[model samples]
Target: MRYVSLGSGSKGNATLLEHQGRSLLIDCGFSRKTLLQRLELARADAGQLEAVLVTHEHGDHAKGALALCEALDIPLYCSQGTAIKMDWTEHARWRSLTGGDLTRVAGMSVAAVTVPHDAREPLQFVVEAAGLRVGVLSDLGSLTPHVIAAYQGCHGLQLEANHDPEMLRKGPYPPGLQARVAGPYGHLSNAQCAELIRRIDWPGVQYLTAGHISEKNNHPDLVGQALALAFGSTSRPVHLLAQDQVADWCEF
Candidate 1:
């Protein structure tokens, strides 16, 4: 199995996972043109995608899912609440999935895990194929025990390091917005992200990618420091995802 980030950050987010000649897209935050361009960067084409999975209804996550799926005549998978929030009922290609539900698509098994976010019934995912597991987690405010359990034993994992708490406190965002971001239902702080990696089943993970960064409140150096603290003395590979470009593929 192999995976690559099409883009990751506030402006948009998407990832492509390929296994056994089949490709599955996780999220479609960009327009058709932009998505196509990013796909080309990874040496893939729209015709190769068997389905698109959405994690939530946020614009940066679900914005282009329906249109792209409709245009390509591919199935769109998401929580029932996410589908309703996006008003995707009219589309015949929409496939509803509830949190904790496992389904197969594009020759891969996907398990949706519910997450706590401002959006209605948001979810993250754990995907598996050929006995290999990869977890895609982002946009959740806090980590729950369920999340930790769901993400265990991943061959690869993409976790969000959205912001630095100190920077967020003094940053440009107003107090209310800051509170929301630092709140229990908002994005994870660098410290919290570090804590999560410390508590998860880290030894089994071969590849670790940090993503969905806040350009204004977090720096790559800060994220690196946070990860370094959590992964002391370990040589497991780590990759940082960028918002503007496609990332190099990580194959296992």
Candidate 2:
């Protein structure tokens, strides 16, 4: 299996996973045009996308899901709460995904793990194909035991490192916004994200993409330091996803 991140950040987020010529899009946060351009840059074809899976209703995660699916004549899957929150009352191509249910989509087994976020019903995905697992985890403030257990044995992982707590506390965001960001339902700090990496079966992770980084409150250097701390003497290739560019493909 191989994956490419179209982008990852507060502005927008999307990931494309492919195996054996079949592809799945995790989110379509960018407009159709922008997403298509990114796909082109990555040498990927939208026509190959079998489905689009939405994590939540947040604009940065779900803004262009419907449009993309409609344009491609592909199905979309999301939690029922997410559908209601987005006001997608009815759509012929929409499929409801229940967290914890292993469903087959696009020839892959998708495990939707519920997460604690501000959205009505947020979910992160761990997709398996050809005996390999690739996990897409982000947008949660805290990592529960369930989350950790679900991500075990992943060959590829894209985990969020949203901010540096010290930077966030001293940054330009207002007090209320800061409180929300630091709250239990907001985003994970660099330390928190590293802790999750530590708690998980990191030794088995072959590809690690540290993503969903806050442009204003976090730096790639800090994320690197945190990852180094988490992995200790262990070595692995780490990719830091930027908001404006398509990341290099990671194949496992």
Candidate 3:
């Protein structure tokens, strides 16, 4: 299995995960042109994409989904609530998935797990292919027991380390916005992500990628520190996906 992040941040986000000759995109936050260019860079033909999975209806995640699907003529998969929020009923190729249900598309098995977030129906995905499991988790305020269970034993993981609590508190966001971000329904803090990592079974995680960092509130060094602490004295490799540049292919 191999995965690459086209980009990750508030500006835009997209991730490509592939295995056994099948490819899937986790989000379509980039412009159509930008997405196409990144796909080419990864040596992927846009028409070969098996499916596009949406985590939520947020602009930075779902903004370009419809356009991408329309252009590529690919099927889109998302929670029923998220479909409604995206008004995907109007699109013929959109498919609705409920949390806890397993579905197959293009020979890939995908399972959605519900997460705490402000979106209509938000979910993180655990995808299986070629006897390998890859988990894509982001935009969650906190991790739940269900999340831990779903993400356990993943061979690769794209986990969000969205912000630093102190940086956010002292940063430039307004009081209300700050409250929302630090609230139980907003993004995860650096410490929260570290705690979640400690709870998960990590021996099977061959690749760990930190994503969705806040440009104003969090730095790559802060996220690296937190993860290093959680993965102390371990030889497992970690990569911080850049918000502006595409990440190199991670193959296993």
Better of 1 and 2 by lDDT: 2
Poorest 10 consecutive residues of model 3 by lDDT? 229-238
Q: Is candidate 2 or candidate 3 better by lDDT?
A: 2
lDDT of 1: 0.89
Candidate 1 runs further than 4 Å off: none
Residue 4's lDDT within candidate 1 is 93
Give lDDT tens digits, candidate 2, residues 1-252.
Answer: 899999999999999999888899998899989999999999997788999999999998899999998999999999999999988859887899988989888889999999888889999999999999999999998888889999988988899999998999899999999988878889999888888888885566788898999988999999988887785626785679999989999987
The 10-residue segment with the lowest total lDDT in model 2: 229-238
Query: Candidate 3, residues 134-223: lDDT per residue as tens digits?
Result: 888888887788888888888888898999999998999999988888888888888888887888846877888889999999998999
Residue 198 deviation, candidate 3, in Å? 0.8
Candidate 3: deviation at residue 225, Å?
0.5
Sequence-dependent TM-score of model 2: 0.97
Instruction: Candidate 2: list runs displaced more than 4 Å.
Output: 232-234
Clashing pairs in 1: none
* Positional deviation of residue 152's Cα in model 3 after best superposition, in angstroms: 0.6
